[model samples]
Target: MAEVLFYHLDRQPLDRVLPGLLEKCLERGWRSVVQLGSEERLEAIDAHLWTWREEGFLPHGTSKDGHAAMQPVWLTAGDDNPNEATVRFVADGAGLPDPAGYQRVVMLFDGNDNDAVDRARAAWKEVKAAGHDTTYWQQSDQGRWERKG
Candidate 1:
């Protein structure tokens, strides 16, 4: 089963919403992935996450012998996808389970444009249409999120 977390920005940049989201993912046992949008917000939040990593704010179930916490897997589109160190970070984050095998998957999205929102919804729809246990979500401009069963 794959669960999706959809957010309505309410006219805020992703930076304002991302950190709390990453924290939510950590708390809910969902691996985090960021899309290739908002480079400034992405970079700023990445650095902030790094600071959290150094300050012992990482998640539990990390694999390294002396590792402290788990950091979200930063997935930028095309050129800036995570590097080896980030792969290690993902591994440290809940031991990097194979997503294909994950029975419960939760996706967090910054819902701003219809194109992006539609794209995500379409993907999830395809998966659900294919007979997988899934849920889809979209956030409205009125600052309310709607989930599709």
Candidate 2:
């Protein structure tokens, strides 16, 4: 079964939080595909990952980048894992595809957005009912992630 993780975004925006998560994925030797809700989001994330930090960069590419299979992180607005990624990050209200091929699936939802939170709740139930191992993570008062369920 795939591991499904839900991140309730309260303390930080996705741009700040996502790079760190992707970095962790890289450290574990896992390639990743970040699926966003729109083509604009995919483009924005592609640029953000390029210059989010001055000293570091997350090597990634979108569909326009040509070499999809060579990217360590593939960014897309669609359900395509051209990089053969083992992990998938569903952000910005993007709907998840089947998680069978992925080792881990992360759904990051805005905690302040009622619709996003509601979607996350539904997704959590659906994933669990589908027999996947699911966990809920929320930011603590100190802004650190703590698994709540």
Candidate 3:
């Protein structure tokens, strides 16, 4: 079964939190796919990953970049997993893909947005019913993640 993690982003925005998570996946030698809710966000994140840090960047590409199999991190607004990623991160209220082939699925939602929180709640139930091991992590006042449930 895949492990599903819900990250409640209240203290920081997605752009600030995502790069670190992607770095963790790289350290574990796991390829990842970041699914966004719109093409605009996909473009924005694709650009951000390249310059998120001053010293180095996460190796990533979008459909326009081609060579999907060569990217360590694939960014897309669709459900396609061209990189055959073991980890999938869904942000901006993107639709969840099937968790069957993935080792882990991370859902990042804005805690301050009621609509986003509601969607995450619904997603939690869905993933639980689908039999995935699920966990919830909320950001503390210090911006550290605390496992809530």
Candidate achieving the largest lDDT: 3
**RMSD in Å for model 2:** 0.7
Candidate 1 shows a clash count of 4
lDDT for each of the candidates?
0.43, 0.93, 0.94
Model 1: per-residue Cα lDDT at residue 23: 72
Off by over 4 Å in 3: none
| Pairs of colliding residues, candidate 2 | none
**Tens digit of per-residue lDDT, candidate 1, span 44-139:** 545555455555644322122222223345444223323222221121111222334434444444455665556556556665665656554445
Sort by lDDT, best first: what order? Answer: 3, 2, 1
TM-score of candidate 3 versus the correct structure, residues matched by position: 0.97
**Residue 79 of model 3, lDDT score:** 93
Each candidate structure's TM-score, on Cα atoms with residue i matched to residue i, is 0.47, 0.98, 0.97
lDDT of 3 by residue, 35-108 (tens): 99999999999899999999998899999999999999999999999999999999998977788889999999
Residue 56, model 3: lDDT of 95
- Name the 10 consecutive residues with the lowest summed lDDT in model 2: 61-70
